[model samples]
Target: TTDSGVGSTPAAEAVAQRLRAAGFPEADIQVIGPSARKKNVVARLHGSGKAKPILIFGHLDVVEAPKEDWSPDLDPFKFVERDGYFYGRGTQDMKGAAAIVVTNFIRWKQEGWVPARDLVLALTADEELYGDEDGVDWLLKNHRDLIDAEYSLNSDGGDFQTRDRKPYSIAVAAGEKKETILQLVTHNRGGHGSQPRKDNAIYQLNAALDRIAKLRFPVVLNDVTRAQFDALSALESGQVAADMKAVSRDPPDAAAVERLSEDPYYNALLRTTCVATMLEAGHGPSALPQRAKAVINCRIAPGHTSAEMLQTLRETIADDGVEIAWQFNEPSDPPASPLRPEVFAAVRKATDRMWQGVVLMPGMETGMTDARFLRAAGIPSYGVSGTFLEQGDGRAHGKDERIRVSDFYAGVEFYDRFMKALAGG
Candidate 1:
């Protein structure tokens, strides 16, 4: 379901109404939001009261997709299956996973299966884009007890990479980089189109961006990345694997780091990354721009604070005229989740049952997720998805977003077993 109301209120409340119709108690299900348009839905399946609740969360929001950008005959809002893939806006991004979680919850209830502890299914809103109305943030700030759990399984993490439709490994997102958005504004005196000025706001902004484009942050590694490289070694071969291993070292190989730094994907994994996403200058094309503003989006690595990244950015820009400021309030640094043995064991058990010989690696997502907020709030949040997407098959937030039909069903089966293992069923 799409959150047409901008927040999840319309869609989430729809799901809650379905849960209520399916015999869920009123007290066990809650739809709360700061606004009526944006709501977070929570449903609890009570157990024998032996253990703390386990949270399974997925956002109900999808990134906006313009109709003109999509392929012919493909409406982003409509589900269409072709060529063994289900095409839709949220197909791969996560509405598919949310449906899986809700389906399982209903199945367990229908089968009269009781677990050792409560299982909370949280379908939240406003995760695609950030705002004060973030569903996860709102829930934690207001009704923390309704959805509080020892740990959470976030479906909005990373893709489960596969090769030739065969599962090679599942990258369990153990940690994620935090977001730091900065606004770079350059000011100049407005002038008529006929009168050319040397001090152009747009030119200064472009120059600053050019410097940022060439600049690279120093490579850094944490437990999650180190373990990721160690696991990745088995999947990769030759120098690439060797370079990965070397770069992951406590004292990383300088040559290997230098070589890997040339690659964007690998570079993002090794260090914090910032890029100019949006730019605006002048009111009209004929007018001399009085002010130019560019938005720089940074994914700060774990163990680094946003303030530190901002300071580094300021130094990199170094232009006195380019005034830099944080787009959002200063962010609190969230620590990486530890590799708990029990958690790994549980993943292994489920993976073995689903795709035997498939590896499960502790991966750190390059993009930020609500998991960071949960982790900052002292909950061990993990990005775990059973859905396996082939290499180069990821289509989240892109035109004609789709997921393999087989992979979708496989995910359904995997979560059924996974939840049982986690809840001691």
Candidate 2:
């Protein structure tokens, strides 16, 4: 297990010991790098040599949750059970998944069910704050042999019944957007606050922001996203379904794109998006600034490049004085794991066994995950956590995060069957 934010070392060590006590071999389990309290724990259960190994991945780190904002009786780290839900910071996003993986490992060992392939569980850290230190990035760079596998199931996809309690849930997630951070700077001659200048850096920076906010990039749909919308539309009713069907049949219409973009979820799938997250200007409140800067977080859609997005920004801002600098760039294309018949069949069979014939659709994730790294390694990867949830729970990365205990155990069953089916056990 790993920890996400400040003070993750203790939590990571605690979870490691728990795994050891639960019958994981001490030599096979290794905790690496809790730099800034970030750490990743890896364990494996060797299988009969019937199929290639599968990697089961989950993040141990979580974003910050303040004690005051939570319920008075709630503790972020304390696992609580109420209303069939297991509540805690990492419940959904996703210590629960890690627990499921660990439990299954033990169960498989106890049952002596040596199936087709080996299973590697990588509970990683620093996934919440970018994967620089103890997360997938570090693993891929430093310890590839330990967790390398034929395919990977990165935690973060599954079906959740909507707020209205729909009977079906979507089982999908294939590709993800590439994350890029850019800094925009506007500079001007320093002057006293008492004497205002029209071309002051602050004014220029605000103007650039205004232009960025108003401009909308053209929509470009890839195969994965198109498939996702089609499957989702098939499951819905009313105009939403109709809109999705229309777009699925033809290319993304300007009108439809405009409408869908208004919804935060659909907007991300359609095109690259930029959000200005941080701003700084002037040395002090009383001083006039010589320079102003803003940090823009851009998620480049598949088929888009950072260079192209940067060029688009330059054109949109249209100010020679405003300069842009790249803070970080990890250019990625959608992972090339084909929605092949065999792979799809495996997922479908698993879903049918678990959910009694629920529709399984292919989806592209808006947020990035470690699948990108595995894909880069020429390994096929998919996000296929079998746990289902109720929509609008606002649990992931939010306060009062929880997952149904039954659902957690169900995921274990699904994954066990999935591995067996995939490796031909």
Candidate 3:
């Protein structure tokens, strides 16, 4: 188990040191970062100098887990297997896959096997926080040549849905939504609590929030979403299936839109979504609120701009009194990576080889990942983890996180086939 942000460096360095001890050359291994506690480990294996290298990367970081919150029998750090599941903090979120990648690297070296093209492993740091000292961003800016590859395969993406322990679909993330934060601040003169005015800052802020809630960004579809619906339609039944097929059409079905909009998950996929996440108002309980502010968090759809969304917010509120501004750490979002046929084909072949008859679907992730940075850096990255978790059992960053032992072992085999398909034997 690893601490959310601080554990990445030591854990990564430990992996690098182990590789070196296993006779891996020092020139091919590096522990790079800004400080001692925040390092990223990178390693490479030389192959025939024919094709561009393929990157297999995952962050060592996992979200914080407190022992007090978990069941007594389940400790966050202790590895335990019960009822076919491996219980641990980072079991499902990522360390499971991270360990798999590192193990594969070691196994390949021990077996004296080399691929047709070079393979790079970038076990990074600060991906969970994604602050100024992001590992992937630093590497791209300062040491691009070290980890640069034709494309990258990240364990953060592909999602497997199962029911009753039977795997259904393999959803491979081809793109992801961008994150944007907008601040809505309302300022007014404070008077005695005895005289509450209509233009009170708190009242104005509440009104603005109501308007924002009622406002719906226009429905838009991209290549990824369309393919997602096309593939998902087969799995769904009744109105859900019809709605999925309808949304995939050139002119989306309006009734279908209304129906799906009722569901938050599908609604987020249909268009950019915004919600008031943080609120601040009033100095004291007895005082009139002089200033009221809120932080609006948005997961914007691909091909949409924060500027456009801000404009829409202003128009939706239709009020000049509420002042709005972008957050200081606004996201510098990258363009959605274009879907490539070969990449999807490779994922499908790998999935079919491991779990035959499982559907491979293209998806756009609502949450952000390091893949965005790689995509912006001109390295097409895909999220295609081999592990399967039940439909509602994805305990990422949640309490009592665990993973199926069978799925964990299966991923090792899946990745082996996947790398061969992409880089050739």
Candidate 4:
């Protein structure tokens, strides 16, 4: 169930009605929650054999896009095909995958092909806006039985060709960084704007923000990232490979880590990162603000906790007047799903068959996803998508987000085969 928009419900019922019209039995398909704009769309393709169903998951929610900022041709809700790509708010960020899943389900039914394992499709809500009322979170909490499965594929990772469209990098997100909201508050005496006080709250808050901006958190590597770096190192050139290898070693080579940190991607993987995102101060035009607050969004490494990170931040920006407040903290470590024989073999065999020996690297996602919720429930979840995107597609949450039509269709093929193989075994 994807949040239609913030408080708005998605048009999932319309999608659900379409599924029912496509020959899905009423019992085989279930729409949970109210019949509002946003709701979960669930469809089951019953398997023939004894294998447990494989849950195929994606979100229907797209971040809100202001029409004024975009080009006249770009409308967030309209699915426009332009330059071989589908232009929509949810095109690449996710709804495209959902559409593929829905299409695959309908096609599977039409073919009358019963798989070895059932395929469960769940399109959920409230992901773009991080809230407790998320579909996955709600399901895990209230309706765990509906999602019982041996394995699942989240809609976040996949193979994408290089800028030159040569080789492909098929990333499988094995884990993700945890989120910690750090609130920093500085208190000082209030006075008229014309007559400023020595201990101004804004000034003090600015100093803390400045320190946070300049301060560098120490690098802390984990098992997943180590493997990622090692794999990338093998593919890179002379200096790049050498640098990546150095940083991937035990007791990380400080020089190499420092140098590689210059590259933002590798840098974030190696350390706990904190960025100041929101700030608030002052009430009126002529009044001096008594208190100032800034929110720092920090993605903690596996072993660290919110408290520990907050303490580090407090110590880093040493100031007795500035007090740190925590807005929210959720543990982000995914339960152990070994990249060893059993799980790895299935993924490798499927990916290799589809991509013709593309590199399948077990990587950590910098951003969070529904996989975290599943992992917390002792279910092994892998963030793998079957599509590919060209270079310069922009980050998931960035502007002009898009995915190629070929990539979308390729995902259907890859997932169809991959799911069949996984369930067959």
Error of 4 at 262 (Å): 1.7
Better of 3 and 4 by TM-score: 3
**Deviating ranges (above 4 Å) for candidate 2:** 1-28, 34-38, 162-167, 284-287, 331-336
The TM-score between candidate 2 and the true structure equals: 0.89
Ordered list by lDDT, greatest first: 1, 3, 2, 4
lDDT of 2 by residue, 1-425 (tens): 33323545555577678767767788878788637477778877777785667888877777787777788899877789998889988888877776776677667767667666787888777777664556787888889888888788876554445344333765467677888888999887787778776778899999999999987777867677777788888677887887776666556666667777789888888888998999999986766788899999888886787888999999999999999999988745654366656666887788777665365677777777777777877777778766677776758877788887777777788777776687654
For candidate 3, the 10 contiguous residues with the lowest summed lDDT are 1-10
State each model's CA lDDT, in order. Answer: 0.84, 0.75, 0.84, 0.73
Tens-place lDDT digits, model 1, residues 1-425? 34453556777888888888777989999888877777889999999876778888888988888889999899998899899999998988788888778888887887777988898999987888765356888899888998889888887875587888898888888898888788999999888988887889999999999989988888778999998988888888998889988977898998988887888888888898899999999977788999999999999888877877778887888989999988864357888888877767777898898776787889999887888778988988888866788899788889889989998988888888887887776
Report model 3's TM-score to 2 decimal places: 0.95
| C-alpha RMSD (angstroms) for model 2 | 2.8
RMSD in Å for all candidates: 2.2, 2.8, 1.8, 2.7
At residue 142, what lDDT does model 3 achieve?
90
TM-score of each: 0.93, 0.89, 0.95, 0.90
Ranking by TM-score: 3, 1, 4, 2
Ten residues in a row with the worst lDDT in model 2?
158-167
Misplaced by over 4 Å in model 1 are 1-7, 132-134, 190-199, 282-289
Q: Tell me the deviation in Å of residue 254 in model 3.
A: 2.4
